[model samples]
Structures are given as C-alpha cells and as structure tokens.
Target: MIKLCLQRSLRPAVLLSRSALDPAVTVRKVPIVPHIHSCQMGTRGRNEPREPLNSPKSAKDFIYSLHPKERTCLLMELQSFESIAIAQETLQPTPPTRAQIKYVLFHNSIPFVGFGFLDNAIMIAAGTQIEMSIGITFGISTMAAAALGNLVSDLAGLGLAGYVEALASRLGMQGPDLTPKQADMWQTRVSSHMGKAIGVTIGCILGMFPLFFLSDDDEEEKKKRKAALTAPNA
Candidate 1:
C-alpha cells in the first residue's frame, strides 16, 4: 500500500510505501510547486520605466538618483537656501514701506493744497452762490474719486501679484508645499506697495476737505448790514 501527503507553501511532499513481506515502511520526499505571493506578482507587474540619467524628468528625479543619505542632505540644503537663491535672481523693485508711503503722501499733499486754494479763490471771485456750491461739490466728489482710484489700483495690484506668484511658483520660490510663514511673507511683499499707494491717494482727498469752506463770507455780511440800514430808513 502507498500513501501520499502534500504540504502547503513549496514544501516537499512525503510518500509512504509498505512491503508486505518485510513489514517495513519506506518514505520518499517529492518536490512541489514553489509558492508566490499575489502582492509580489502585482509589484512586478506595476514596475515603471526608469527615467534616463541623460534626460532626467525633473530636479527631484535627478536628486533621487543619488545615494539615499546624499539625496537627503542635498534636499535639506536646497530647502534651506532656495529662497535666498531666488531673491538674488529677482529683478523686481522692492515694495514700499510705511514710512515711504507717508513721505509720498506729504509730497502729493503740497501740490493738492496749492490747487485747492486756487480753485477756492476762483469760485469765490466768481461771486455767484452757485459757484460756491460747485466748489463744495467738487471737493466732496474727490472723496468718491479717490475711492474709485483706490479700487482700480488695488485690482491692478492683485492682477500683477497673481502674475508674479505664478512665476514664483514655476521658479520654485513659491510652491504648493510652502509653509505658513513663507506664504505670509510672499503675500506681504505683493500687497504692501498697493496699500501704500491707496493710503497716499486717500490722504490727498482728505486734505482737500478744508477747501470746501474757503470762500469769503465778507460779501454776505456786507449785504446783511446794508439790508438792515435800508430797512429802518424805508
């Protein structure tokens, strides 16, 4: 009689045979098919084509070709110094500071003050009540005009910022993986100049407010005194 036992997992099978005359059992080992894991087969099937050294797809790929420790150190160095390198390469002018904005406002106000006084003198000399009202209306209208100017300037600034941010992203100065502090720094640089320009414009508009009341009141006073004197005589 013969009996066979198979084992799981690439192990050898055992065969048992008995001879009727000798009453002794003989055992033999037989080889079985090797076991293969499904995961290993899938991994082999999913192998991607390697990028060539001569034509690397990206900086990351070029870095990845280095030894593990060397790659890690190089990446760390790049992360630390990337911003400095980009800033050195930049050709754009620096954004205006708050102090510079104040200076600009002061300079702009000088001209605006001269113009406001001239306008008031002209309206008052015209001597029509309607001309005085027109001067006041013009002063008030400047506030609205300043607001519109600020809006347009802000929109233009935002458009320019967006274009710069896109370029920075491409150049690796700004990227999707940037930390919070980095993003804030980038936003500050982009917005500070526009804010300064808007502030100066508003300052000039506010400086014009006193012009609205600059017309001479002496004429009205003289007219009132003349009316009183003539009333008693009449």
Candidate 2:
C-alpha cells in the first residue's frame, strides 16, 4: 500500500518536471507592476510642506492642536476685550468768558431804571445805624465791584482802541499805536486807583456813622461828676 501511495505522489511530480523541461512550450509574459510605495507620498517632521486646510471646516481641529498655554491665553484675551468704553456722562461747567464777565460788570455798574426792591433793600440796610452786618456786606460788594470794574474798563479801553483802529483804517489815516508798556501802565494805574478809591470811599462812608452812642448810665456818670464839682465842701 505504501509503494502504491509513493507512486501516486511521484507520478505528478515527474510529469511537472517533464513539462518544465519541454522546449516547444510557449510561456506568455506577465505584466511587471511598478514598485509604487504609499509611504513615499507622505512627508516626515516639522520641515514637511503642509497643504492649506479649508477655513471653518478644520478650525476646531486646529484649535485642539494648540498648546494648553496658548489656548488659555487666547481665551483670556478674548474675555478681557471690551467692545466700547462706558461713557461717564457728566454736566460740563460753562466757564465765564471775557465778554460775559464784561457784560455782567457793566450791567451791575449801570443804575437800574426802576427802583429795584433788592437794591432799595440793600441801600436801606447799608444806611441803617444798627448791626455791623450791613457794613461788612457793603464793604465786600464795593471791593468786588471795584475789582470787576477795573477789569471791564481795561477790556473796554482795548475795545475802544480796536474801534479807533477800524475807523482810522476807514479814513486811510495811520498813526503810531500805543506801546504794550504804555497799555500795561494804563491798566495798572486804573486798577490801583479803582481799588484804593473804592476801599477808601467805602471806609470813610462807613466811618461817618458812630457805632456806639452814650447810654443812660454814661449820662448819669457825667452828671454825678458835674454835681460833685459844684457841691460845697462836705
């Protein structure tokens, strides 16, 4: 049985060897596949050229790849950004301009046409021989008026000079202008005189009224002295 099996296996092997040895047999050429490696298409490390990713598509992926520090910093900066500065709404103070100051001074200096209740009250209060309150108030008012008037007059003088220059130009008559020194001297003179005159005038006027009057006690004291002098030796 073993010999029969060996013969059966060797019969096919002998036939294949005879076929391989045959010179008359024609063999068709199989096409040679090119050695194309998939790995060769992929680039390596940091220097590798990357294709641009589509926007809004791989944005999450790009963000996810960022370092934790960079991600936190970006988020913090975004959170701290303010869209607009909150405005502090406030009322702006309107400072007094030169013209306004002048107008105010001039208005106060000019006598009112009608009897002003306030002015009359002021005058009556000032003229009274009573409390010292009126005197102090009048003094302050006088000083303030004088100071403001001095400033206004100086401004008015300048305005007059301007008007004169305008008129002179119209008349085609040019003249030497006042020097800055002369103008300063004039202003100083006016201010000093106004302040001193106002102060002195008010002082003198207030001084006219005696603050104290002799009471009954003083009169009695005088009478007693006179009676003692006239009395005969006691």
Candidate 3:
C-alpha cells in the first residue's frame, strides 16, 4: 500500500489531482506510528503523561530521564555516560546488631578510659605540686592552681591522644562492619554516649587516688567553712 501510494505520488500533478477528485479511487491516509526507524512522530508519547519540561533539575536527571531512542540524538562520546560508575542504591542497609553496638561502645570507651584517668590524675597531681612549690611563694589561689593544672592536663592529652588510641587499637576490639545508615542509628549513638559517660565516671573516681596521699588541708578547710556557716553573724 505504501509502495502504491509512493508510486502514485511520484506521478505528474495533473493525474494525482484527478485521482483525488474521482470517488472511484480512494487515497488512504498513512497513519504515523509513535516510533519509525528511531524517529518519533511527536515529541511526547501518546500514553506518556505531559509533565512539565522543567521537571528535571540537573543534567544527570535530564539525561537519566531521556528515552533510549532519544539518546540517539546525543554525540557518540556523550552517549558513553551510561557507562559511568554511579552509586547503586538498591537494598536497604541492615540495622546494627546488639554485638555491633556493643563493639562500638567498647571501641569508643576503651581509649577514652585512659584519657579520662590521665586527665583527672594529671590535673590533681599537677595542682598539688604547683601549690607546694610555686603557689606558696606566689600566693596563688587554689582555684588558680587547679586552672593551670587543667591546662597542663589538656596539653598532655593533646600530645598523648595518638598513643592512647594506638594502645587501644592493640586490644583487638575493632568496630563492627555496618553501613552509614546503621552506624547513625539511635541505639548506636546511645550506646556510644553511655559507654563514654560510664568510662569517664569510673576513671574520675579512680583518679581520686591522689587525694589519699595529700595533706588534710582540704578537710580542715571544709570543717572551718561548715563552722562559719553554722555560727551567728555579728
């Protein structure tokens, strides 16, 4: 039918008009299909929704949303974008297990254990030494001595952080393998916070070992303060 139409259309204009005018011969209208030799008859598909052209926000979205046949219009080199390694986000990540959370808890707590102990112990020891040596001569307040001692402890922490981490690593208590989503879970975060809090509390309690070796000045001051508070003011 197409061949016949093409043959007749190729004829002289006089005969083509007569054939159209005569009712005896019928001229069939050629229906246009959606896709013909990779060329679409219309810009939008018949069944496809007429979405806004500005729907795509970026080049990637526009390209990814392009129909396979539509991609034929692109340059050969540009067409190779399909080969680019993009992140494949398919399956949902598994939630962290109890053991995994425990691992994270211990992994974080272990290193901080030494840190807390050292920070508290060093501060106490340093403060006491400062009071005995330079504080008496300079008439430095106990609060000032404590503040300077804390500074020394912080500086020491800054230096010894790597060593503490290194020592903790030798314990063979590595964190569990989990996705970012799993690691960010409330349970994991809670476990981490709890572990650090508990470790530091214990470390601070242990760090009070220095108090047993110190003079009874603090006790005497506490008694004096209590007596003064209880006594009537003039």
For TM-score, the strongest prediction is: 3
The whole-model lDDT of each prediction reads 0.38, 0.35, 0.60
Off by over 4 Å in 3: 1-88, 217-234
Model 1, backbone clash pairs (residues 3+ apart or across chains), number: 0
Model 1: what TM-score? 0.21
Model 2 ranges off by over 4 Å? 1-184, 205-210, 232-234
Q: State which candidate, 2 or 3, has the greater lDDT.
A: 3
On residues 111-190, what C-alpha lDDT tens digit does candidate 3 reach at each position? Answer: 67887888899999998777655565566788998998998888877766666666776777645665646656888889
TM-score, ranked from best to worst: 3, 1, 2
> Lowest-scoring 10 consecutive residues by lDDT in candidate 3?
79-88
In model 3, the Cα lDDT at residue 10 comes to: 27
State the lDDT of candidate 1 residue by residue for 1-234, as single tens digits.
000111121121111112212347454554333332111111212223445444324434554445545444443333333434333343544545555444444433333333333333333334333323432344334345444444444444433433433332343321123332332354444444454455446545553554576446844754565566567769
Q: What's the true lDDT of residue 11 in model 2?
A: 41
Clash number by candidate, in order: 0, 0, 0
